[model samples]
Target: MHISEGVLAAPVLISGVAAAAAGCSVGLRKMDFDKTPRVAVMASTFFVASLIHVPIGPSSIHLILTGLVGIILGWASFPAILVALLLQSILFQFGGLTTLGVNCFAMAFPALLCYLIFSKLINGKNQSLAVIAGFLAGFCGVMLAVIIIAAALAISGEQFITVARLILIAHLPVMIIEGLIVTTIVVFLRRAKPELLKGVV
Candidate 1:
């Protein structure tokens, strides 16, 4: 879902940078110094997860795991995702440097939204509901990112609509896969490390 450099116009790129900067500012402020280790771990997870792509017809799919990070780190997912994307761009050129802001925002915004919407339910008392919330977080995270990506491409030209549609169709399997993965992880964390959910509001 990385928008390559030069694909997006200057206005879109600037807007992405400005919006991501604002989110990163708030995320940095909300991030507790003690949780730096957890953030780093998740950043690494994000970095690795996105690199393992599976070919499906003309398009490829990968596990974002952004929802997993978001629920754990809350707003801090912004900076974590930013760092991961930067490294990916610098080291592998997976995403070009000029498009870094748009790529990061595309991935991170849905993560923040998922955290805000699902964090409470995941932390709530009912296990069943919490599991459902986890699944939704993962499912919706990809869906929202898909929409954002489509919108970004749609802005570039009319022909991109078809490409965007294909991208969404290709990602359908990933949505289900990530939802199940996140649900399982949430259940495990609920049993073994409930404290991770305790402090995050």
Candidate 2:
């Protein structure tokens, strides 16, 4: 979900920028140089996945795949998302440059949160638990992003309250779809490339 420019108040925008900067700093520090190519691939995936979106007031409905990125890239999702969003803003203008920080934080923070909450279970020996964790991660990722976007809208002004609610309602189906998609990916990775899940965070 990308918050359009001018929708958020100045204070909200400033706070978003500060928070995103902090996250990017941490992500950069934790990033593995050797895995740069993998990070690029994930960024490209994120970029492509969100290309098609249905505009809803200040935000939009789209398949973010933040959970998948988080599970594979961990904290690195901050920079990856930032890069993708930056490109989208520059190229397609899906989101404005002024709103990049808020949009990036809204999407990437949930990803980082999901990674922190489910990474261990996803890497655990119990395959069933891992699968469950994967589903939850994907489900929660979209849910959390919706919450953040709603909050940002509400905080901006009372006019956005209705739009905020609509955004939440519109994304329910997306959550389930994302959950299933992530589950399938997790299963495949566990069987074909277990190493991708380990030592990521």
Candidate 3:
């Protein structure tokens, strides 16, 4: 769920923005030329994957495929997410311009984590393990994003407990769906396009 600009307080938003900037910087600096194609795939996947919106309770949520992004792009997922988020803000108004950094951070942190985890697994010969790793990474990424969003709201407005709770509850199902799809996608890609994940290690 995209947080409206007015929903979060200044301190939380500012902190999120700072973190987002750092993440983007690091992700961009670490991008390798050999991995450019993979990162581009990640950027496109993130942009397209997020289009499958589903309404759980009060808010609408969508699949992020961030774990997939991480597994493919590694640390570069941060810049890729920033790109996708920037476009979303301009085109769909999914997130506001002022909050773009925060929104990017919320989505990108889990992606970074996923990249770390998937990097290790892909180094192994067992394809199944890699797929499983991808699933877990995706699940964690979704959960962490939810937590980040809640934390930002809580920090911004002390009275946002109900809002956070509602968002968490609504996103639970979406997370599960995302997890399943992520796992399946990872396996499919592993079989169909192993080269895409070649340099993630």
Candidate 4:
């Protein structure tokens, strides 16, 4: 989900920028040169996945795949998501430059959180547990992102409260779809490329 330009107050925007900067700093520091190509691929995936979005009030509904990205890239999801959002803004105008930090933080923070919560389980020996963790990571990524976005909108103005509620309602299907998609992908990667899940963070 992307919050359009001029919708947030100055304080929120500044806080977003600061938070994004901190995340990117840590992400860059932890980035592995050997995995640079993987990061680029995930960034491209995020860029393409979010391009087809349905407008809903100030934000939009779309596939983010942030959980998969986070599980694969760990802390690097922040800069990867930032790059994708930047390209989306410049090339398609899906989101504005002014709101880049907020959008990036909204999507990437949940990604980081998912990685922290589920990465170990996904890497564990039990395939069933890994699948469940994958689903939960995917489901929670969207859920948490929605909450963060709703909070941002609500904090901005009372007028946006209804829209925030509508956004949450509209994204229920997306959350489930993401969960299934992530589960399948996690299974495939585990079978074909288990190394990808190890020591990513």
User: Which stretch of 10 consecutive residues in model 2 shows the poorest summed lDDT?
Assistant: 52-61
TM-score for each of the candidates: 0.90, 0.91, 0.87, 0.91
CA-only RMSD, every prediction: 2.3, 3.4, 2.7, 3.4
What 10-residue stretch in candidate 3 is worst by lDDT?
192-201
Between prediction 3 and prediction 4, the one with superior lDDT is: 4
User: How would you encode candidate 1's per-residue C-alpha lDDT over 15-103 as one tens digit per residue?
Assistant: 88888898888988888788788778767866787777766578776778777777877888888888988887779878877777777
Off by over 4 Å in 3: 32-38, 53-61, 199-201
In model 1, which range of ten residues has the least summed lDDT? 192-201
For residues 49-97, could you state the per-residue lDDT of candidate 4 as single tens digits?
6666755568766777778777877999899889988887788878888
lDDT tens digits by residue: candidate 2, 23-119? 9999988887877787888678667777657455687666778787888889899988899888887888788877888888998899999889999
Candidate 3 has an lDDT of 0.76
TM-score winner, 2 or 3:
2
Candidate 3 clash pair list: none
> Which stretches of candidate 4 lie above 4 Å from their native place?
51-61, 199-201
C-alpha lDDT values of all predictions: 0.82, 0.86, 0.76, 0.86
